[model samples]
Target: MRSDGTLSLERRRQEREEAKLLVLRKRGSRLAFEWGLQQCVKSVNATPRLLVYLLREVCVLAGRLARGGRV
Candidate 1:
């Protein structure tokens, strides 16, 4: 009986910790998204096409790095 009670208590503690971590993760992602959006909006002559091109270039470079090639 005592062990069962301890296990329940530990389970509750773990659940509370998980909830806190999820909230923190959400807040961090929201902040990052807002920051990136602000930068994109503030850029001069920024367009969807340009953004797509930049993303493609980044992916290409990342692939090269993953293949052990100089980016």
Candidate 2:
């Protein structure tokens, strides 16, 4: 049978391990959140380019209309 001191030490060790696992889980969740945020930022960055392309098309169509050409 283990002595009281030995039992206390074992309990402390288990608690430390549990604490470490919790820390690791928190870090993993934080990393996932950061990655998702980065993907959102990238998608947002593409919006201006799409708007520019659509604007150019509209301008070209307007020019054709002014020249008496069919759309």
Best by lDDT: 1
TM-score winner: 1
Give the per-residue lDDT digits (tens) of candidate 1, residues 1-71.
Answer: 26555556545654554454446446764443344345457765444543554565567768889999985
Per-candidate TM-score against the hidden true structure: 0.39, 0.35
Candidate 2, pairs of clashing residues:
none
Number of backbone collisions per candidate: 0, 0
RMSD of each: 16.2, 21.7
| Per-model lDDT | 0.53, 0.51
Q: Which stretches of candidate 1 lie over 4 Å from their true place?
A: 1-45
Candidate 1: clashing pairs of residues? none
Model 2 C-alpha lDDT per residue in residues 1-71, reported as the tens digit of each score:
26653556545654554454446447764443344344346655423333453455567768889999976
Kindly report which residue stretches of model 2 are placed more than 4 angstroms away from their true locations once superposed.
Answer: 1-46
lDDT of 2 at 22: 49
